[model samples]
Target: MAAEPQTTDHRKRPRRRGDALIAAILHATVQELEERGYAALTMEGVAERARASKASLYRRWPTRAELVMDAVYSVIPDPGELPDTGELRGDLISVLTRTARLLDGPAGQALRGLMAEVLPSPERMGQVRAHAQGMGRQMMEEVTRRAVHRGEISPEALAPRRMEVGQALLRNHFLFHHEPISDEMVEEIVDEVLLPLFNTSPVNSAT
Candidate 1:
């Protein structure tokens, strides 16, 4: 009899645990978002790419939307670590520009896909909404707090809506418009909108 050939078995690979496994899965998720995009991404696809078990992903994220959201969030620049440009306009522009870049990448794809997914519970949808919006606000808060400390704006300038407007405008244009966001638009947002909104003098100025 002719010698039989043996094939490599992927299943026999050493199992990954804890952070290493989670990191691999998230990386695979982003790769899928970049390649297959969100609509076509499946748990099986991510598991196969990550060389992880589907059950591992399911154990952490019960739904595809949840998995995608977590994966997208993991890749976002941390708000607490954003650089301070020492002035409100510079800081605003830098933060918003970084966000614009994020929206132009896998994070953007994940958002578009998640928007179309029909979750079984309204609560699940709410969680998705919260996670999506919360990070933007947190980033704004980081910049705003720095501005306030530098006396560039009144503490009152840090209203919820004001904090949200820069990100909101960028997201609105990104979601609806066909073109990549322009430098002029980012500047206009900082100069024409955010700067004026945040230009309030101190509350005790008159005293």
Candidate 2:
């Protein structure tokens, strides 16, 4: 007697696709960053944690730095979303404070790891530069544009370096100093460094 072939128990959770899959992968990346950190994080590790295939991660992010950058960005506020506090100082403080806060999280962890790993390779360094420069610089540019429109500062203040100053200082402190950047430090950066740099007399300096 020929026995009927047993059916396989093929009931598995419906696969996550599109944004859902991306979100799962990103969440897994963040968890890996927090737990194993960037130094130990790998695409295989992220894929395993996400319950997705290694090919899935590789298809989206070709490299570890790319994956880590996207994961860090996923949890942080959009750089294009500027805080309108009605004044340059208020906006500056608000933005800087937000960055300082993020530094205490997965973003900072990724930065420390990337900085260590990407320095030797120019290609990776460029990727890191793009990631670092894009976030804070875009925010600063919008904030500065608003300030200029408000007549709070002159257009001459919008130099590449000027836009980079606040973030550079914050990152320096975060990397070299310690965690949980203080509100007082943020305020000092806004009041002392950023404001002065942006509002400097035209006669005194250029950008």
Candidate 3:
């Protein structure tokens, strides 16, 4: 006998495939950056690497800076994954350690070189600067929010600071390429330089 038709389970929305496309493009861009470095990294290169045409890439990204920014976004760890641990020291250390790891790799070298080359163009520099600010600020905001939620610091204290600690750490390497920045130094900077500044700040005073 023929079996009766079972009731269909419906209501599930079709999954968005755009993320996959973006992820693919991002991955391809990263590979190109690493293999070719900044000087050779191009839209045509990324398109060829990604198996898509130059037109497709242009539709999504009008400029090399924007494409590079998207690729950067794809690689950096999502803020949600960062642990709170309820202690500023631990949180800062964790993030720094991670940042160091990313910088120590090939992609880091490619990006650092790229940063130097793009300085000649005011327009390109502006685009790169804005992208960096958006990503860096967002990450710092996450850490600051965690600090307040855990009673680590006053909400006002952290917000006003604009999360310069991360910037300072990266600047150490960017500004002085030869100076050896150690993980030990990362801890020392966090403990010695930043911690004291926040502790005595008026914004952090008990509300």
lDDT of 1 at 179: 60
| Winner of 1 and 3 under lDDT | 1
* Candidate 1, 1-207: lDDT as tens digits: 999886545478887899999999999999999999989999999999998888999999998998999999999889989998888888899988988888889998887778667456688778877897799999999999998898877788787767778988988898788467888899999998888777754353324
TM-score of 2: 0.86
Using TM-score as the yardstick, the better of models 1 and 3 is 1
Please, what are the lDDT tens digits per residue for candidate 2 over residues 117-161?
888999889988888878889889888899999999999778787
- What lDDT would each prediction earn against the true structure? 0.86, 0.87, 0.70
Please report the candidate that would top TM-score against the real structure.
1
Candidate 1 TM-score, true structure as reference = 0.88
Clashing pairs in 1: none
Q: Between the candidate structures 2 and 3, which one is better when assessed by lDDT?
A: 2
What are the RMSDs of all candidates, in order?
3.4, 4.7, 8.9
Candidate structures ordered by TM-score, highest first: 1, 2, 3
TM-score of each: 0.88, 0.86, 0.77
Off by over 4 Å in 1: 1-8, 119-121, 201-207
